[model samples]
Target chain A: MKYHILIAFFLLLTNLNKGFAGGGEGHGQAFDPAGTAIHHISDGNVYTILDGIGVTLPLPVIVYVPEKGWDMFSSGHFHPGHHEDGHHAYNGFVLHHGSIYRVTDPTFPAEGSVEVQGFEHELENNGGKDKDVYYVNFNGTKYRLDARSTLDGGVLGGGITSFYDFSITKNVVSMILVSLFLLWLFISAANAYKKNPNKAPKGIQNVIEPMVLFIRDEVAVPFIGKKYPIFLPFLLSVFFFILGLNLWGQIPFLGSVNVTGSLSVTMVLAVLVFIIVNVNGNKHYWGHIFWMPGVPGPIKILLAFVEVMGLFIKPLTLMLRLAGNISAGHIAILSFIGLIFIFGKSGESLGGSVVGSVVSVPLTMFMMAIEVIVAFVQAFVFTILTASFIGAATEEHHHDHEHEHGHGHA
Target chain B: MTGTLAALGAGLAVIGAGLGIGMVGGKAMEAIARQPEASGDIRSGMIIMAAFIEGAALIAILLSILMA
Candidate 1:
């Protein structure tokens, strides 16, 4: 368990290394407000076209925007069923090619705020000028921005502010909680070990003991070989770090929170795995990747090129897969909650609301519960795969006696 | 209109998959319980088989989502 805490210390060191090496830039800047991390500018404006199908459609455009706040105005984000009695409800936006869009800020008719043209938000919405932008209040700081999307009709929303209340809108608060929890966890584990180094690990150790041992014996030992001890620290760190974040992300508001979903965070994890895998890869492993064992010389050369590309592609796939799976789940659950309005606005007569409202309850509940398993499974898959990659890179694949002596660790 | 039914179907499919995985795991444990020494070998098979089941179910859910 103390080992898990040491991973936190490594996290601190890497962060400090990042701070000293080149300040926060690019992928290193997920939590950084200055960069395009969680904060995204969305294109695709929302429009409430009353003609077709009696439903307002949210249209999205794939383009780039200077600020993340501008995504609120994209048509792809239109909430067609957002209406509620006399309250300000949504009436536009549709799913086109798996993305949402709508007229950005169609209801914010404030005199000083921005306005929209026939199909765009420009100076016309703000008095008489075009390009009048709106500000999103974070904590208390206001972020200004414009909408951007992709060429294939997808709004790219980015830019996130942590000013909202610590428990509500602040990711920093959640991170601090994680850091403090990690500190407490480590200290407790260390104290336990200090009192009795080999007493079967009591208390929290009881739960974590099996898992830590599992990673080393199950994941690290076979793939990493004798150097498993050296890499054990990093592997254990990643498992717990991700597991902790995963569990935390499941904690109600905190669970709904997007920590690991941030590209910056995923990028950092991928880079760490990349560094460790490359730094520790043995000779025969690199040889196999670059030079096949039994193939034509020309084919071997081609395979070598592909193998080299595999290095980056492998980690990239891992990062995207993890981030996409988690984020899509979060968005889907929230979208379900947004469905009640759709039925109401579509004039479905209040009857459907009962089923929609009642059914979503269990659905969302089930989703929340499943997310727990997903959290653990994803973390395990990542840790296991990382170890596998390292094992593959450093060791040659054994076909003849692979399973005859599979249980026997290398 | 049918999205509701599709969601319910998605839930059922995942639940079925989850149950299938549980059966595979439970059986593995039972076999291990019967033969403690073969736990390692049985466990490996269990994990691989479990992964296949999970992959199948996950695909089903994905298809369900796309269809829905």
Candidate 2:
């Protein structure tokens, strides 16, 4: 066991050295820790396992432009070179930094593959704010590139662009993989139960039974009450889906896909929860929000305003909390690993690299362990909060008599 | 610089979150010690409350990151 563990650590260090080397090679720039960390966390078009080893899995590229219509092709057509930057442009779309961008210049070739020089980043002032604009060099002419449109309305520095990317990105691939694995696991467990009838639970059934029971007994029963059965499936699905993705992201050498860490993903989940909670809200829930019983007229209106804000704020917080926790964990781990490059001065000093490795390995290991616990905690938190929201909305109110009794006692 | 200020804001938010979670964990520990059998219930409750506090701090940190 000890020898195996030692061998594993040695292999990990070698891979880490190679990964760092690959990241710093083509840029000819000083190691930028923040940029590297952000890049690793962000979604990408191509799945890179170990860049230094040149092991990359190509994903499908799907994009749409108003004038060009829909274009679908394999991302491998770009012949992703160093840093996953495309060495060629396919149908005027260039892959840079693992994202697809369209060349907007009219003179640029609109059809067929063309060898491109490279990509350059420049700070361009748009109105009052300075934005990072990207340009592609093709045939010795610099052509401005438009990023895939985002629905953030420029709040996150992304707005409507010339095209839309509907590609099977790294995150999408991870979600599909996780969802399939979960389906297989649960279906097998269900089958085992059916075959055994009343026999003692065994195999996969044993693994899943306790978690389902825990959610049902602890979260659903206490919060949702008699209607627990109605919401049980939804709660279970949310919990396991999150937990699966969290654990999946924690795995090393698997592209480090940050599905839950992405704000867009979490925003979708929050929106779903928001819609479900609001739709299921009973008369009492609406009453509490619009007008509290027995309150003064003016104060009731004031309270209503605050209550309405809370309704929106709850889901907003839910979105931010999960994404923030997961992303922070990923960033912390990346930063710890980055200490090697920083201390080694980007491999200028072998002794510094050794010293950095000695310090970083243990810290990275510790952070990974903490991340495992966080994966569970965040999953539980999301599910329990959802349960609480549903519970509050569907709860039957008998508080009026209790309020009067409490007042009399006081 | 604006970057420095954003880092400072994120640090401040972490401080607040640290203090808040520390209190929640401390009180929960005290509660569990007083009634060991109720530890399960208290633990979940503590986590939920800590998550709420974390949500507030996370929003602030996110704003700081955006500002930077």
Q: Pick the candidate with the highest lDDT.
A: 2
C-alpha RMSD (angstroms) for model 2: 3.2
Q: How do the predictions measure up, each by TM-score?
A: 0.54, 0.94
Tell me, by DockQ, which candidate is best: 2
lDDT by residue (A1-410, candidate 1, tens digit) is 99667555433322322211211222222222211112221111232222112233433333322332222333323233321001111222222211232324434332222322212112333232223333333233333323223232311222232111111122333456776887788779878988998677789777777898899888898667876777788888888887787777666522245666654567689898988888877676677677766669999898888888777766775575566557656655555543432433322335544444555556777887888888888788778778866776666445573333221111
Clashing pairs in 2: none
Q: What tens-digit string does per-residue lDDT give for candidate 2 at A1-410?
A: 99788656644574455455434324656777877788789999999886556577889998989997998999998998777788999998999888889888879998999999878878887775678888888878889989889998788989998999999999999999999999999999999988889899988988899999999999999988999999999999999999999999999877778999999899999999999899999888888888877779999998888889889889999999999889989999989988877877777767777677778889999999999999998999999999988888888767655443111000
True contacts reproduced, candidate 2 = 0.85
* Model 2, global lDDT: 0.86
Off by over 4 Å in 2: A1-25, A125-128, A404-410
The positional error of residue A111 in candidate 1, measured at the CA in angstroms, is 20
